[model samples]
Target chain A: MNKDRPDRTPESEERRAVLGKMASATFAGLMLSGVLAHAQDAAPQKTLIPARPFKVSSDANQDVLIRMQGELERAMQKPINERRWGMVIDMRKCIGCHSCTVGCVMENKLPPGVVYRPVIDEEKGTYPNVTRTFLPRPCMHCEDPPCTPACPVGATYKRADGIVVVDYDVCIGCRYCLTACPYQARTFDFGEHWTDNAAKGADGALALTAARAYQNPPNFEYGKHWERGEGIIPKSPVGNARKCTFCTHRLDQGMLPMCVSTCVGRATFFGDLNDPKSLVSELAGAPNASVLKPEAGTHPNVYYLN
Target chain B: MTRNTKILWALWIILALMGGIGIFERLTMGERLAAYTSYVPWGMWVAAYIYFIGLSAGAFLLSSLVYVFGVHKLERIAKLALFVAAITLVMSLLTIWFDLGHMERNYEVFTRPQFHSMMAWMVWLYSAYFALLLGELYYALRRDVKNLSPREIQEDDRKLKRLATIGIPLAIAFHGGVGALFGTVSSRPFWHSSIYPIMFLVGALLSGGALMTFIVSVIWPEKDEAWLDLLQFLGKIVLGFLLFDLLLEWAEYSIPLWYGVGPEADLVKFVLFGPFWYVHWIVHILFGVAIPVYLLTWKRDARSIGIASALVAVTFFAIRLNLVIPGLVTPELRGLEHAYVDPIGNRLSYHYIPSFFEWQVLMGVVALGLALFYFGQRYLPLMQTLNNREVSK
Candidate 1:
């Protein structure tokens, strides 16, 4: 045995690993405590303000609710640091045939009553000089999403990757998000299916692959849910809050969402928005493109080219 | 079991039948019953959600008179208010769930909290408010049990007291936060007003107080003490909230009209006077505000109070609708296709109608609330007025 070498006992190795973990945890905790303590010390000091002449503050000042809710406004100003997922729709190019709506339905397999996409037809001008325009709509996935705040459980969130997603299992069936959404872009899966009869091969068609479902899936680095029939079984039914995920299941396989792939006009494009080299980047920079419902402050992902 | 039971049952049955229609529209026609399309994703369900939200806020405000104001004479009605608040919250949530396309992934609220999202604030606010209500309820009950011997108390008095105390401040936080849910939106002109939260709070108090008069009368408190005082207290609360709500509305309404509002802001105006004018007229002004004010505070007998309350329950849900739906229906741009969103951020939910299955689920939730109220009132120590059954003229 080399004199420089320490003991070869298994217990020492175990102890070393344990010590290493403890050191890392302690470091993290110390850093966290320092941050919290600093924040506490830096709490905003209250300042006196002039009272309104006629307005009665009453107990209804709502200072508490407002103070507690400051985080939301803070979020509104959180600054889209990373390539904030955005979209550009060219209003001039839309042909109102309901192709996007039809394609979305065929791709997403939404229950009847629920349309993942739609062609909004607008009649402009009056009398003989009237003109009509069709605007296709999808979730804006707002930078300051109204829907996200309404969720009681915080089941939905925006990913660093720039997509808004919902975690199905934890949703308590409260649809606050539905009401909170100003875009009216969301849908509720009211627990209804193709049919209520559960036993009659009632697996309900998996829209991921159609043909009732897909099979013989390959493992992808992301979402790994390659097989349509072999995807991870979520504890939710079709009736839960379901919306578009930009085909994350497909994105994992280096593919685009079904709707994007099948767009008859090749109107939709998909890619990592952060990389300036990406096609969406070039399109976003192009002056002819615009996004739907940009006024809602929900930075959407779907762009349109006129 | 009795004729009274039969009457309540009939009311329930009628309610169920109405809800059944919503369910049918939801399941069969999908976006058929209502014109909810992806371009206009929300419809009746969003309106219903807002309505229930008003009711919940109103109910909570009513409960606060007894809790925060130290008016324990109004105490007997407080628990019922709390229960009603809980029930209406469930109804509001059910409405939203039925409106979403991927109601399946509605989980994101809990798993993901968007600090910036007004929707997220609502989720947290409601949760915290629920907690607060539960806390105050326990506190209200705690002293009663404490004064009595250990044998006379229920199983978990200590924990109950702790929880109830926690709920007191939470109720205020909850409704205010709910107001902020809409107020935080800079896009929709109607919702963008800073006074919206204040409007919501006053509206809650107004509706809650109005509801209490009716609920108190229905129970037919034959021998309860301070019946007169309770009625008087409720009148004041209702009048206060109503005036406040009206003033806020005046400010909210005139501001946009005065300004050369953008296309989105004009949409709110459209909702108020255009296709949705009826809702503004019948639901918001007449049924929600004016009718209840007249019924609750008018020089009338106890029966009028009950009817007024039942009406308040009806109209408060309506007021919530006025708040939620109108803002949403207004297009984000001058012209856009999708009006609503589904759970997974899909544009499809904008066109949802409550299916029959959705209605069944909603009915199930409502039934559950009713059952809870019935059983809680019957078996639990819900009311101090239980022993005194008569409301003297």
Candidate 2:
């Protein structure tokens, strides 16, 4: 019970702290190598074959046009900083497959009730004008998050890299922030598991990533820490609130979030918003791009193109 | 021994019966203790937590009038009310924790301490309040210990005075802090109102008076003139608090309602006339406030007033439900069909129902609180001096 100790050797406490730091660093290092390697091969190489493209602005005049031209030149010449994690969803392409939910579930090793992403099926109008739009919801990874302040223990927070993560070990399972969240984006870990082969879906690789961890290692970030073919699912911290981490572990390993890649309709886009050359930036600049619930003031990072 | 033992046996039986139902549910339908999801995440237990917290604050404040201010007539039931308040507050916190998905990780509140967390602030306030109330109780018992002729003070008497002495102000801070929690949430128009803690404080005092009045009548049926005079004075305070609470709520609602602020105003409508409409009008307004006040003042009859006070006590829980739930149930989105669906995907016809086990644990907790209060009063000389007759035969 004596947590503080001259009674205990200083070496013991020092060893424990060192071990904790090393464990965390090893995980981070693995993530860095995975991501950098993936980025090298996967990043699209482009030839800057010079072509003059004109973009129109309203109130084009001698002075206005000259000022706008100067602004455009400066914008094109600016150096790129850190990549901002972002997403673009094309409303036109969504087919309501629920594949995104499945991919998220598998990648994150979520519980039965805890889904990191869900597809909202919207049917428009009466019979004559009936139109259904599938809205896929991953964590918005809000720029101004509501869930952050509500966490009494700071168990949930946004990472400097723009990912929102939960500290599973520190979460007291008091779901106050869960209620405080406006998007209904959070899920409770009810100590659930896959009973039988019910969790087995069509994709073989997906099954491995999403396999139930019966005694789940405290995976605040997801990776296959559990050995393959163990058949025994380790339980995560069962009683805490959980949500999407914007695929942090996968991003570290130079991969697209499982959901974005597995989308049958290819409706989802993921990339650095800060990079001018990123495809997501181009799509987000389109006329129809919009974020969900702008009134919420949470300033969501996800954009949906209608 | 005969009557008291019989009462104790009856109380124990009641506790066991309620606990049995809780156990059955946890065993049988453990996975499905009524479900919730990200949308409609909170429910009855959260309300109940605030309810008991309110009661504790109310009771402690009443005791402070005696211990801190030395009001002689009110002193009779000050200790009794304080004892009930303490037990009730504990029951409240326990219910909410039991309802948590991550009950095991509850320690994170202390470990990480999101200084920004309103619930965390409330937790600290509640604990500090509990400590203060315990101290106040201890201090009140100083005279009792002095009268014990230096035989190391009776264990029961010593415990009460020592705890109450330190705990009185702490109890106030905890409950007042609970009020502050609701007031601080700038979102959720219903809860974000600045006057919320004041409302909570007033409500607690009103409910505390109501509870003590009922306890006296139930446990000791024969009412004397001295108790009746005290009862009348308490009734005035209760009704006055109720009047102030209504004014605050009405003014808070009117700001958005008059503006026709669509979804913002919609929450007020939910309480006033939507799904939970009846709770607002009937339980909070009618049975909770009107009938009790009417019986006390309009009737000007002590028996009727005591009966009304009992009515207020019995119905206070319903009032708490109205305060906590409706604001939470309102969807942040205006139109996401089933955006505000019961977390279990509307499998049950009712959006949210407190499950059988949930009820059992809750009932058991309530019974336990009452039992604690009863045993506490019996052992400690909390009652006013009457002829100095020996309580023990």
Candidate 3:
């Protein structure tokens, strides 16, 4: 054997491959940390500007809700069409905490059969090296929504300001739109209460009272206060297909979407995409930004950052 | 009453009682008792609705052959077919109306319908068809409606034939429109095919013809030599439609699955080999197609053909189930089936099994149909017409 090369075995080659993968993964982690650091640095300066006449100077380094709330107020002053509302969700920052889901439920007074936003948890790889990923899904509100045309009753449609809405009063509850959706974002209202069966058992009366109070409150969805109840002709949502509207009624009051304000990771961004200086515009215009199911040709306004 | 009649009455009473409970639940509780959720909205009722509608279309078309095309051999049963068609049409409308979120708002289709939807078009076409069907049935029964003399009988026949002529187009349009309703849904990859409408038409012919054959053989008042001849002809026609329907089904299933690709491929495989694979293999192919085809071809008699046709009629519901459920069972997005879980409400998950309450409602609809048929047989001169024919001979 030539002594020039010392101990170059097949085992060494296997080790080399494993080492290479580890190096790449570490480099990727470092790159993500850099991006997060940059985001933190840029946030405070944007928050310092006086967004409204009655508002005091908000610290740029304040919570993401305050920054986004300011952005929402500025966008509301523009004409509706000139305001192309969009959302940007950064996948890297999401903690899978489900705060957004809970916040949405509370804000909408969601009944048992209805859910406006849900956190999807996906686990990748197999054993020890496995990592978990969380994707919180809301309605895409597509520019060319497949759901709208599929509705025989013309109950659901896309607004000029880029929010898709369902007219509960007009909806016949045919559920054709539910099947048409590629994202599976829509759910039907089956007119159930959380404390339905509890009312028949021990300590059930108190639970029932709490449920009725929580459930019957006026939910300002689509700018109308809806007191959901069970009747011969139940209200709009009770017999209709429902989905996320980006909290349109809240937007009318110059507030950010419930999900955007409630995200624990501050991963969600919301503002008019038309406004070049808006936080959502900057994030959505980034190269990493992408939409779900691009092959579907839905042209969704919701963008995701990896 | 004979043994068969006694058994039928017993069945009707039991079903009616059960169905009453379902009706009560539907009236008081609304859609809360049903197993189908927002994810899988349509269930057994929607399938039953299409099944009854298809049967009505098929029976009406068979009647058209005798009245419009002047098939003298099938003339004796022409009135019978029209009556069966009308009953089935009523049942279909009732089932679908019950399926509606707001049954009272069904009149909205007539008032505020948007023409772009195939559903709207289907409803309109069927309403027209329903009108034509009533008109045709009335004319067919004109001899019994009045104490008509022989000359008047001839006049009634002319009116009946004219009404049947108008009914031919109405039947075709409404039935084919039902197919188009499913076919035009481009979002549903499983249903969005040109052949769906055609498949529905052929299926209607097979199932409807078989049902009529069963009814005629078992219930015909005259078991004379002519009755045997009538049964033989009806049996042959049913066999022909069944074979044609099978051919269309082959084209429907095979073409989509040939390459083992496309969104439809997995869904078709699920129908053929999934958890409910028996619905297609055992219920549809074995009982509906194979056994019936064998009996018709080999037995070549009224009794055998009647039994075979009845089997085909009952098993044909499996085909309708396969068409409706599988189209909706699969989640449009991957992982959606597991995204949200609702164990009690049954509205969150994509997986669907029709609740027992749903079955009860269906039973009620069937009992209603049977009761209607029973009353029609007793009060109407349906059986007397055959005695008159014998007397004339």
Candidate 4:
């Protein structure tokens, strides 16, 4: 094992203390049971110690990301259909920085006029009594999704894991699904570009070339490389109906969604709902947890903790 | 050609040329030039489509009066009406085809149709109706195809009658299905009503009958007493339907406006008093209904009736426009429009007005329809019986 560095932070000290407590507890249990007595006598210097890859905190709420990461890895071992993906956003912790929204756009390479998630800023009451609230709206990935049935070509459907996905290749871009969604989660890509109105080489070719280069890279959505094309007969996702997929491509790679990872206040949590110990399942089980437009009867998998 | 015919040709050419530029832009730019955003998904093209399809259904149903019900006074224009129906159906299909994001994949609706979707059902119904229309049109023209025995003529007439009987219900189903397409979208309260299918039928009859009356009064070759009498009969039918249609409109508008509280009420108020209020007040109420009602009731002459019918037929587009756009202007969730702003694309906005490109494409559709009508009238036996009557006279 590598030696502990001298330059230690308070968080590292807390983690080391937690680890030491766990080690002592395990040693006491093993001594009482006499399971490791023979091994301890043979190799007194080397006791069988458990491997702890993630930093442990004494307070359960302090290392939520680390806990959630562990849960995600455990859930990934299950079959795809058995794992029901879910999300929970704690609105009290959200500062409305819009970092999650920006992260989603960057992660998916969303074009202009198309968005997967947007935080709604609403002001309630009037004058002195007014209070502002932020509600981040993403695709509910409903159990009974209305948008899926509205697809005339059977292009959009709910996966076995409860994620609603659009088959970009099969989508006819009718925009019927856009109207069908009560939450207005779906948006059609009008095949627009950031540099559509920018002057060609106005400040020399550097800015224009860089912008083009940024747009040229293929986005890995649904585990497929999608290179956005220009002109009338646009590429698939450009004309297809798009919505949030809970970052399924990332989830498959044992990584959390971009929005969940980028949330500064740790407001967003994502994991398999089938696992009762998952962070999302725990948050969603709370009495304050609810969904937007419950009257729509969509039975959304995404929950918001008020 | 007459001076009127020459003027009509010049107008057609001008419209086609203007629309060509818009069509070119649409083909090259995709939906970039369209004013409709993700918020207001349907726009002028959708309205135009319903308008043209209503005309087709109405014209076909009018022809049913001649073939199925044996209304001999309407016999002279029955074939002409069928031709008009077929032409308008083509125009509606073309207009809607351009509205599709993947126009090439339209065949997928047939190959991989999801029956739960009303749009898929409507497309299937339209295909069935299109085939039935062709069959009916062929039988109606078979007697006039060349020299034929009297027995062959009688046999063709029987086939025509049978086809018309089949077509009447088919026309109602497809047109009513169009209304149901909007009606079944329970998300939009304005369109979610049982009355929509009936309203669409009434509107079709009024608009389609007016167009037929206008053609008979103004464009028919013969100007004898028989022609005048037929025009008067068509005028009375159109006027009755117009009044009935108004009563339905009143029911549609007033029932929701009485409370002025729900989502449907807000949409109704928006259609009446919104920024585009003139579309309903000046275009539809004034030109489409009031002026036509006044002329049809007061003057009663062939010239006056012709003008009235023309006004009603042309301004019915405003009625269609009101039906489609207002249902979509309001956001489903409050403040959702302000939540995400697409400054560069301007496609996240709730507000929508048909762009110049949209109107230009519509104008092109109308021009194409006019061209088709002209060619069909010139070459087909649409007016064979009427010409034979004139020759004998």
Candidate 5:
């Protein structure tokens, strides 16, 4: 029995040596492939200058905002047509605070009756079974936009980056686009101001003067500085069809849309769909992602995750 | 001037004054004083535009019966019909021009027209129609311009016939294009229909025929048996078109309401039984259709026909209002109206009633139409009787 044990021990040691060699070779092969795949994945990202460099988060998941902002910065490096702008709204995260709406208003300096984003609050079921849901509606920036063709003067058009923009100077204010939109996203600027009816404060103190100053600061839309003018002949935007431009002016400066940055619950995601690594693209690929009025065949860039 | 003529002049002057005030306000206030919101982008001005354009199309088509079809009975009033068409067309253009947000930029539709847009097509078609109308009018009145040889008169008549022939299709296309402007908007389910163009054409004929009949019965200089015969003929034409228009309207209303479900059904219900139900029931049906039908079929006298025709002509405005307003009143997206409220402008709401300023502008258009018609009838040879022409020959 002692002799048999000694012989088996040598054979077992040899077997262990063979197994160890095989395991080491397999581990080496895995490490090489992983490094190669990572290099392949990050080759395009190497050229991009992230607006905010990403750090390994201590949390299990990175904040979507940081990820989206990085994606946006990366997208800005690509050609305009190569970078298709898209948005995804996480309905579950929306708290119905309407900060995005307010943010859009302030960002665009929207007058009364002109809204770029509005949160639609709906109550479902009856009594004890009732549940409330909020939907933040923004311009879809449709691929096949009905509003674009409806303009008599070619005033409105869809850009290569999937953004629909209206040339305020060319718009005749016919409002045909307003009726043509199935989403009701477009609004006509009716030359209204908050200070139209404000009281005149003793000469130059408060109210009208202050309100005028606040309202007069030009909003940079489509990367153009536009001052809201007054008088018998109204200004361009005053009589133009206005809508959310996906914050193109902000995007031009390599910044995220006002609505995206203003989202308190991180419900809104904005990034380039062309870059598969984008947060919006990842979120938009989810099974729950859908568009409003899908039957309209507008092929909206905006997605909603229910 | 007779008392009626004096009264019309007084009425026109008052309307013109009221219109001036509205025009001044519209120019200065821009769209601030207008009640239409982005939700309901069009209102009374659009309705008035379609109404006047329809009248113009109908009048032009009636004139076609005289020139193109060679109907001797209608030839006597052909010039009058042409004049009415031209003047009403002017009124339509004026009202729509005023409705634009930038009235100055309206020329852009001509300059940089997008062919894909129905509104662009409408403007182009109407501009062509307007030019053709002027040519046709010039030819129709060419012989009246001066003493002409038999050959000259014959040539003028031939030219008039050719112009009128071309005008028949031009009028139909322009008027039909107007309907298509609304119909092609797939976003508005109420207006997105194949039947709209056909319905608009028929409505134009019915309303225009009625207006002409009323004018003939009331204003024709000679109240002879021949005049009565012409009035009776026009009455029959109006009645036929009236019944046909009602049928089309029934189809428009019934096809959607048959299922009693869907968005279209809801819109139809809104038109039939909504807050402005009286527009359909009382103004359009009772006064426009029912009374006219009764008078034309039973009474058949000049007086009864006159009243019936007058009612139809006037109440047709309500028909136009129904066509334009209901298509926009409902929100494109459910709960969209409540999504955002305008605190200062109050222009975000779906609710719209044409403000007094709007009515005043319409009154101005009406006054303009009346003044042009009156001056044309008085100064031009538009009312040269067939007997006078025969004697002159």
Candidate 6:
């Protein structure tokens, strides 16, 4: 009834029409936003980077990984013995993410109890001024590895390229090498599978199927495809003493160790120590560089930059 | 069968059943059934191996007193001691063999031996000791064999005595070498000690002699004046060895703990006050040393001495457990135990307690040893001498 005075007026009619349009648009905008938020929540958040052929980047201040990859290619051209492989970890830059650990497991198909890389967490100072420190430990690959000489069967020996390799066929699995290590870096494989003790129902069967696929095709470790399975005389790595080989197979194929490439903080460096210009050699020569248990006389190839 | 024989058979069958499960688990599951992980790779089995080996060495050395040095009172028990050594040696080897990751690959120790490793050297020396044991036992048994003539019988005893003379140093080397195997691991401060080899040697003598004494007292059959004299002499030797072993233990512990500092001190503290404190305090100290020492010293009756020796032999395994576990419990690096964990498999953890399966395997090993001893006693002329050729004629 109040609108009757302006009912016939064109301006009033136009205003009413404008208000009606605005209300519907507001509701539709809110509903669309709700649907979009839900869609984002369901999607996988991890960024997938596709594998590509090695290429030296021409960009200024190239990524550490690209530079290291180029360095690795150059090192491989030299004689095997001449390339003394070394790793340098920068402690200050680490944020304690265990991506390297996961990557190593996936790359090596590591079973339970067998770990190539572990990040140690340390808390310093009193409650009010506390700061947490992360130290990612990989095998030191010592110049004088205590584990090699202790093998009664001489199954484990240092490679000409400075990597310590365990010959699965020769190793008696006496675990003397496991005991001899000063770092306690070596682990004995107890021949365990991940999907152990799962329920026999439908969901469990699905989970097991997925998990079993994860372990299949056997990991290409030590330049050989090792089908690690349980038996009387079990396959290599099932009964054999295992440790970090610095992804030697990957290195052979012009790739960095899984850990070095997986670190989010870009904290780890690997290269030929014999090359003075290499990043690892430069970082290892830094004043702050140090090794674990120097008094042990292991002369470890891994160095940490504080 | 006597009531005692029936009881032993029952005990053995139960052990066999339990041991069968353990062996079956080990074969089927590999190391999955074991509580020991990569963190503590060695476990109760390794401890048992050294314990049984020590007993073998100690018993062999005691036998030498009668055969090599001609101790007249101990002469009657020399063959018995040798038999005990042979059985216990088998038990030790079996324990170690089961403990191997690849039990089949143990032959590699001989074929592709790394002489630089103390383990290889220990294996080699013990193999020689095993050969010597067989030779000595054969010579002694040859005298009793109905096939042998009078001249051959006399020659057998002479050769047995000479073989015993050669075995004295061999026993010392092998037992001492077992100790050295643990001592030379510089990474483990608890095991790395100059006194370890000496301690192992003395421990062998005590445990071995005590077992021999206990067995002789229980089964000598005659229980006459000669038996009493033999028991008394053997008891005195055991008591001496026990005192010496205690002295070595004191040196090993007190010196490290005096400072309340250093890696050895920390490890010793952990052993003295850690989770398995009762293993050292109760099993080893109170039962093994205190009660047995009291029996040996105050109670001088043959039965009491035999009981004391039995206590020493049984509880000595606790000492072996302490030696092996403590060396491994303390982590080489801080935060290592928490760094990564295996929930399904026990091996990732630094903490270790022998699982039921491990105990079962040990029980089986013991049952097998007892069975072997029973068979040897029934078959071999271990107790009675061969028909004296001159007296029989």
Over A34-74, each residue of candidate 1 has an lDDT whose tens digit, in order, gives 44333323323243222431232212123322221222223
Q: For residues B1-393, could you state the per-residue lDDT of candidate 1 as single tens digits?
A: 999889989988876676666555554444223344444444556656666666777787666655556466676787778777877777777767656544455566667666665666676777677666666566545544445444434334345444545554565566677677667656556676678767776776777667666667666345344676676666656666776778887777776677747664475576577766887788777876677678766754555555655676566665665666666654454444333234322334333333455455466557656766777667655666423222210
- Residues B1-393, candidate 6: write the lDDT tens digits: 999989978888999889888888787777777788798889999999999999999999988987888777787777888999999999999999888888888889899978888899899989999999999988876566666776777787689888888899889999999999989888889998989889999999999999999999898878998788879888888888899999999999999899899999988998888877888999999999999889988887899999999999999999999999889887888888877887668667888999999999898898888889989888888988433544543
Of models 2 and 5, which has the larger DockQ?
5
Candidate 1 ranges beyond 4 A from true positions: A1-306, B1-6, B9-64, B72-117, B135-139, B142-166, B223-226, B258-271, B291-301, B333-368, B381-393
- All candidates: TM-score: 0.64, 0.76, 0.87, 0.90, 0.91, 0.90
Query: Rank by DockQ, descending?
Result: 4, 5, 6, 3, 2, 1
Recovery fraction of native interface contacts for candidate 1: 0.28
Predictions' DockQ, in order: 0.12, 0.19, 0.30, 0.59, 0.58, 0.47
Q: What TM-score does prediction 1 earn?
A: 0.64
Candidate 5 clashing pairs? none
Chain A accuracy as TM-score for every candidate: 0.57, 0.64, 0.80, 0.80, 0.79, 0.80
lDDT of 2 at B73: 74
* C-alpha local distance difference test of each model: 0.57, 0.66, 0.82, 0.86, 0.88, 0.86
Return the lDDT, model 6, position B390: 44
Query: Which should have the higher TM-score, number 3 or number 5?
Result: 5
Total clashes, candidate 1? Answer: 101
Flag the better candidate by lDDT, 1 or 6. 6
Candidate 4 docks with a DockQ of: 0.59
Interface RMSD for every prediction, one decimal? 8.4, 5.9, 2.0, 1.2, 1.1, 1.2
lDDT of 5 by residue, A57-109 (tens): 11112466666766777888888999899999999999999999999999999
Clashing pairs in 3: A44-A60
Q: Model 6 residue B164 lDDT?
A: 88
* Candidate 4 lDDT tens digits, B1-393: 999879977888889998888888878878788888998988999999999999999999999998999898898999999989999999999999888887778899999979899889888888888998898888777666676666666677788898899888888988998998888777788888888999999989999999889988876887988888898899898999999999999999999999889999999999999889999999999999999999989988999899999999989999999999998999888888888899777988898989998999988888888888888888888976634433423
lDDT of 1: 0.57
**Alpha-carbon runs more than 4 Å astray in model 6:** A1-53, A57-60, A200-202, B386-393
- For candidate 2, write residues B1-393 as lDDT tens digits: 799889988877887688767745543433245444444455667778888778777877777676556677786777677677778878887777666654555666677676787788888877777776666566455555455433334454455455555555566556667776666654466777777766777778877877877676556434788777877777777777767777876777788799777765877787788876777788767887778877877875677777888777767788777766766665553333332222323421224556665677777778767667768777776664422223321
Q: After the best TM-score superposition of candidate 6, give how far the Cα of residue B244 lies from its true spot, in angstroms.
A: 0.3
